[model samples]
Target: MSFASLGLNQTLLDAVAEQGYNAPTPIQTEAIPAILEGLDVMAGAQTGTGKTAAFALPILQFLSAQTRDSSGKISVRALILTPTRELAQQVHASVVKYGAQTDLRAALVYGGASINTQIESLKAGVDIVVATPGRLIDLMYKRAVDLSQVEYMVFDEADRMLDMGFMDEIQRILKVLPSTRQTLLFSATFDDEIFKLSKALLKTPKLIEVDARNTASIQVEQRVYAVDEDRKRELISYLIGSQNWQQVLIFTRTKLGADALAKEMCKDGLKTQAIHGDKSQGARERALEEFREGKTRVLVATDLAARGLDIEELKYVVNYELPFKAEDYIHRIGRTGRAGGTGLAISLVCEDENYLLQEVETKLETQLPQQWLPGFEPDLTREVKKAPRRNSRGAQKQRARERALGKKPTKRRR
Candidate 1:
C-alpha cells in the first residue's frame, strides 16, 4: 500500500517518495497506523523488511505534528535502543532521512565516539535519541541526557538486544521513561525471552508478524561445502577466485579468527579487511566504507556484524565458521539477498562444525545442499597418526606410483 494511505502526511510522503519507496512495506503498513494511534506494538520483522522506516516514519510524524515547546532546549521525546552501534546508526539514519522535512532533531548516542560531543548535542536539544544500551546508560550516569520527558520508546532488534545481554540495561532505561509512553518492540525472531519482554513492557499491544519467524531470506541461495578444518581457508579462497565472486562478506566465530583470516586472504593477494568490537569506531567505519566502495573484495567479520553492516547488492556471504546459535546463521546469511536482490550464501563446514551445521538445518527445518569442493574434500583422519597412516596407505597410493617412477621409497622409523 502507498505510504500516504498509511496515515502519513504530505511531508512524510514526500520524504519517503524521495527515498524511492512509494509503497509501504508490510511491516510499515501495519505498524505505522498502530503507532500513530499511540498503541503499543510487538512486531516480527526480519532484516531488509524496511523495519526501520516502519517505526521511524510514524514516530517522526508524531513528533512533527505536535506543538511542543520550541523556546527551551527540547528534551528527548523518543528513545530507540539497538543492540549494536551499527544498528543504532542504521535506525538513526532512517529517522534523519524521513524527518528531513520537519524541524525535529535526532541525536545518535553510542560508545566508541566522544561522549562530550553527544552531551553537547543533547544539551542543544534533540527530539529523538537512537542509541545502544551501554552507551545510553553511561550518559544517564553522567546526567548528560534526560529521558524523563520521553513519550515514545522503541526496542529495535529486540531479540538481538536480549541475546547480547541488555535486559538489565533495558529495565534500567524503562524505569526512567514515563509510564504512559508508547512502547514498540521489533524483532527478527520471537522466542520466549521476547515474549516475556513484550508482556512486561507493552500494554495491550497489537501483535504483528510480517514473515515467518527465525527464517533466512528467501532470495538467498544457500550451499554448504564440506572441507577439512585446516583447509577451510583454502576452500573459501579457491571458491571466490575460481567463481569470480565479488563483494564477499565472510563471518568468523571469533575476533581473532576474523583478523587472521583477513590477513591470510590479503597475503593470498585478495583485498580484505576485518571488523570486530576491538577495532576502533573509525577503523570499523573505514573498513566498511572501503568494502562498500569495492576497494576491498572481502570483509571478514565476527557475529557482531551479522545484524548490522548493510551493503547494497552484496552478492556473496561466506561462513568461514558457523555460529554457536542457529539463529545467528540466519542473521549471517541475511546480510546478503537484501532489498529484493538475490545473493549466494556459502558455509564452510568441517568435521568439528558438522554439529553446528546440523543445528542450522534444524532451525531452518530443511537440510542445506552439502558438497565437497574439488581438491579440498574432508580428510577425516587428518588429526590422527596421519603421517604413518599415509605411509602405510603407501602415502595415499602415490608412493607406489613414485617407486614405479624410480623414486626411492624412504625407510620408516621403527
Candidate 2:
C-alpha cells in the first residue's frame, strides 16, 4: 500500500515521494500502523527491507504532533541507539531526510569523532538523538545529553548491538530513559538474547517479521567458489575483471586480511581500499565515499566495520574469508541487494573455512551452490590447512595473566 494509506502526514508523504518510494515495504506496512497506534514493536526483516523508514516516519510524526514551549530549548524527545558510528550516521541521515519538511531537529553522536561538536549540537536543542552506545554513554556521563525527556526509544539492529557487547550499556541507557516511553526494536535476526531484551524492554510489543529467522535475502543470488586460500585473491580479481564488475564490497575476517587483500587488488591495477576499526574514522569515511563514488573498484572490510553501510546500487559482495559467527555471514552479504536492488554475493571458500561455511549454511538453511573456476580449483589431495593463529583478545588476556603471575607464557592449546 502507498505510504499515504499508512496514515502518514502530507509532509512525510512528500518526503517519501521525493525519495521515489511509492509504497511501503512489507516491514513498513506491518510496522507503521502499529507504531502510530502507540504500540511498542519488535520488528525483524532481512537487510534492505526499508526497516529504517518504518520507525523513522512514525517517530517524526509522533514528535511533530506534540506541543512545545516557545523557549526554543531542546531536550531529546526520541532516542535511537545504533551499534556503530556508521549505522548511527546512516540512521541520523534518514531522520533528517524524512523530517526535513517539519520543524523537528535531530543530532548524531558516536565515538571516533569530536565529542565537543556533538555536545554543541545537543546543546542547540534536538528533538531526536541517534547515537552509538559508547559515545552516548560518554555524553551522558558528561551531562551533555539528557535522556529523561525521551518519549520514544528505538534500538536499530538490536542483534548487532548485543553482538558488539552493548547489553550492559543498553541496560544503563534504559535506566535513564523515561520508563513510560514507547519502545521499538528492529533487527535482521533474532536470538535468545534479543528475545529476552525485548521482553524486558518492551511492554506487550507487536512482533513483525517479514522473513523467516536467520534467512538471507531472496533477492540476492548467492554462490560459492571452492578455491585454495592462497589463490582467493587471484580468483576475486579474475572474477571482477572478467565479469566487468565496476564496484565490489569484499569481506575478510581480520583487519590484517582486509588490508592485505586491498593491497593485492591494488597491485593488480584496481583501485581498492580497506576499512576497519584500526583505521581512523576519517579514513573509513573517505574510503566509503570513494567506493560509493566509483573511484574505488573494491572495498575490503571486516564484518564489524561494514555495519551501517547504505549503498544504493551495490551489485557485488565477496566473502574472501568466512566469518567466525554465522550471523555475520548474513550481515556481510547484505551489503549488496539493498532497497529492492538485485545483487550477487560470492564466497571464496577454502578448505580450512569449510567448518565455518557449514555453520553458516546450517543457519541459512540452504546450500550455497559451489562453482569451480578454471585455473583456480582447489588441490584435491591436499588436507585443509589452518592458518597460523593470531593473538586474539583471549590469547592476549592469557599472556597478561602469565605476566601478572611472574611466569613465562606457554603456547596456546588451540
- lDDT scores of the candidates, listed in order: 0.86, 0.89
lDDT of 2: 0.89
Runs of candidate 1 with Cα error greater than 4 angstroms are 380-414
RMSD (CA, Å), candidate 1 to true, equals 8.7
lDDT of 2 by residue, 265-315 (tens): 999988999999999999999999999999989999988899989988999
The estimated TM-scores of all candidates read 0.91, 0.93
Top candidate by TM-score: 2
lDDT of 1 by residue, 45-140 (tens): 778878899899889888898887767667799999999989988888889998988999999999999999999999998999999999999999
Shift of residue 253 alpha carbon in model 2, Å: 0.7
Clashing pairs in 2: 74-125
CA RMSD of each candidate after superposition: 8.7, 4.7
